[model samples]
Target: MKRIPIAAAALILVALGLGLLDLGLLDLGTPDRERFRGMVSPRLQSDKSSDTAPTIQAAGPTYVGRQTCLECHRENHRLHSHHGHATTFRSTKDPEVARRFAGKSYDAGEPFGTYTYHVDDQGLFVRIPDKFGDRPFRLEYALGHRSMTLISLLPDLQSDQDTPRSDRDTVALEHRVSWMASEGQLGKTPGQHDGPPQTAAELFGHRHEGRIMHRCVYCHVTTGEIVGQQIVGLTPNVNCEKCHGSASEHVRQARTMKTPPPFSVGRVDWDAESELQLCGDCHRMPRDITRKQLREYPDLLARFQPVGLLRSECFVQSGGSLKCTTCHNPHQSIDETTETEHEQNCIACHDETTPSTETSRKHTVCPVSPTTGCIACHMPALKLDGLGDGFHDHWIRVRDDK
Candidate 1:
């Protein structure tokens, strides 16, 4: 070929070199070449210390109190304040506790003995008859709002090894006596049975304070932090942070005028199963029960809606399309007010339209009776023996008679 111009020849050589480099057929490692490579590639300029040095990321957030949460969520706070969960645990000094126990005395015959309940300026006291005579035990806390049952919290009779009873070391034990509002009478605590008399010291001997603190108190109260033998900084009732994780980081971000990162306060991407598990942590689910336990305590299913709902065909068929929030609002009290609204929720999935049809492609109509209300027949109210009124069974199933 004819000799090309000097500029055109230089351009052709540069393009050929670049093409060979791109094809990994050339290795240019000279000092001048490496410096040129650094100029072209931005990643080459990245600090080498970044690759070897340890990351100094900030620590996870801590729990800021519920009052901090109430600053922004007043309506939710107001609605939640009226929920049964909000009043599950209360200091004995609360006026409501005093009103419930005012002038009330419970007397048991022979073996069990008699006890007189009285609330005075001194505090709530139960005078129990022992060998020495009637002795007074001061009640420190009250469990339940008396809508169903109310029980007292007594000072821990059994402390861990020689730990002195300091304010920091104090633990509350569930008392043996409980008031059942449905019957308008006091009875032996729900789990405890009526038995022969024992020494005054042995009366609350069955109390497992540590186990109760770990299993029961942790769920009943909002934030129960047990440091050693002491419960440090516990909120008496369930509050916002109980569901949403600690919001210290979130609050800090808001104060600093910065957008908080994802899941800065709590997990935001909870699937249906995880949401159920969050509620199940306290409510108890089928996975928490054994077959033998289920058989022995079938009536307890009323208290555990998650377990009952998991057993239902509706839940199994829907592939987790239904959740607790689908029919019940966690922000509100659980009562008859929500009962009428459940039919609408049921109809959303089980209406007249068939899955094969164009109108409703995803759900099937109720095979038994589409027109009838879903609750009464499918989820009939089952009375829990000691739990007062009937609790509608969350197990959605067909009733033979209906």
Candidate 2:
């Protein structure tokens, strides 16, 4: 881990204040949160605070939740609240979840069949009349923001109060259809096959056993214990502690000590490789995917940003200078950044004025249209298969036949 210079940190703070550093290059525009008002606020308490205290001791860090962060990091907290990470995971009971499905039914066509959504006093449910007859599966959780929300069917769960199912052998569904924000309607979930299903679970959605289910929720939520195939004490969404680590001790010292430690807990020093690994925990690193996937399905790499980014000449040659944080502000949504603002990062290294022969020069200057269009020419936005949206190719490179 490398520490950012104090001068550079100060300049970044100033740029942030002046709106110079505000940028989100991943996805444009914010998720529709109007329907989610008063519905999607993060659960303030960690599971360890109650019955899971013993598990916390075994697990290591004691998470204090994001609410404690607001006491000092007000601005960061405010920005992160609107981020996609904040709303990635939420209960199906969220008002928007119900409203989106109100009087809505999606005919998936053929063997997959039609799916209908409805809300009742009990909870939100999706009924597949063609497959399951009149029997409906209650939608337990949502796996994404408004952009595209994948509904979960937790048939094994005891109740909808938030805790994981008790049984170790329980299974869940990832739902065949997801609410595509672009279409404003339910559509086929990504990676689903066009061929007919071999089983009942295949007819509805992707079936996940214990380990798979735990992973699906683990990445979305901040902190949770994988107890007996169940992720208990779950904190919805990627709140502050997700990256900052457990902050209970930090908060305690802050309040009790007159002269608090400069920085006792959480990560401070970060290099390009370390930051890539940090973000790659969920976003998929090169190691996460097969070499065949990268070669055969290059377009799919658009979603696996860290994978493509690590392969990029920019990251490979930057000497650990270029990384995820170079263009993206982790706390803010990607929509906050414009293409021009993002191009600045390119300009920093690919300086047109810096001669190739100069000893200080380390990067090549773009001979063609250097001042602008860096993103459009180099890292173009690609529409992935099955996904109704586009993502900027993080493999920053020139586009000239090769």
Candidate 3:
């Protein structure tokens, strides 16, 4: 592994902050939390912590945040009582969700007004909903994914779409047109519902609980995986361990105060991989090559893809150029999501006198307005009838919104 010179790395870090890496050619408003700003929060100190401790030799059991952690400390829930991610699986309170669904006046003809139970389709977990009228039913998870410790609405109509199961326990998954957007860019929020269903993977890929792996789980829920009977399932929720590092021990530590001897899981040693592991576990993206899915569950570590992350660039640049922590803070939220918030993450380091910045200082340029959000100009959303109906690309470039 080649190392980056401390000086050049510093320049690139500033360049990235100015949306100069891609030469000012790509729309920067995608709001992809993994990379740049726009989650509407402060930057999450992704910088390496100065603390150092002996590395733990053992690898613990695989943990899912809910079952593994919730059982132990019922008190922390008090602290999180105010957290939004802490809230998941409830009936819809936002009338906006109703409008987004019912008011979507598309000519698909489902009778928005004169209908009872107008929609009933699919959920992250298996579900069957009955339609009020002749239109095919669609199931809706009252809540999509929790971040900012709160609930976010699934914008892509197809994300919650599902079909019916017949006598043989077989459900014919249906694919349809939808306005999709990339995870990072926002160019006109491209109509993601405009692609051809030529391939089997593309057409029937999400008919059912279509193997929620790398690209799937993060969007729906934090810390998701296959549990229960492989074919019959998935337990989706804003699990606790997703952030605190497999709370099994953390929980045990809380009960008896013993996991890390004197310092329990709550005392995060920013120096250890513990902080990075839980986060890099997800923010790191998928690799071109990855682990095999066991019973539809993926080995997150084996599949990390750090999308726009260029290790070579980081290594060759100056030491303070940029650290993973520079743009992301695992403990924060965006657009109300706590897992990560890109749009606001940038503001932390891009402001007039970037206070939280570790590498260098930048002269403030853009006005502090919603439209001037880092992502508003760089990662602009592009809508297409693709995997993410209206996703922002994760490429982290500076270009036109086309």
Which candidate achieves the best TM-score against the true structure? 2
| Over 4 Å off, model 2 | 1-61, 151-168, 225-231, 257-259, 262-269, 295-297, 352-362
lDDT of 3: 0.33
lDDT of 3 by residue, 247-335 (tens): 44444445775444322233433333333333444445333222232223222212222433333233124343444555543333334
Model 1 ranges off by over 4 Å: 1-57, 130-132, 147-172, 201-206, 226-230, 255-268, 295-297, 353-372
Each model's TM-score, in the order given?
0.74, 0.76, 0.41
The 10-residue segment with the lowest total lDDT in model 3: 12-21
Instruction: Report the alpha-carbon TM-score of model 3 versus the true structure.
Output: 0.41
Worst lDDT 10-window in candidate 1 = 12-21
Tell me the number of clashing residue pairs for each predicted model: 0, 1, 94
lDDT of 1 by residue, 1-402 (tens): 122233331221111111112321111121132332222222222333456743331344567777786877788777787888788877666788777666776665545455676888877777655322445666666777664233333344334457663522434444556767777777656554344423343243123333443555666787766564445787877776666656676676667775544441233444576667667766766655555645664655666788788877778877676789888777787653565587888887776553444433466667767765778888887766666766777877776657
Give lDDT tens digits, candidate 2, residues 263-382: 422223334555566677778666566656657646766887887888788877656667788888889898788888988888877885656543335577788887888887788887
Selected candidate, larger TM-score, 1 vs 2: 2
Q: Best lDDT goes to which candidate? A: 2
For lDDT, candidate 1 versus 2, the one ahead is 2
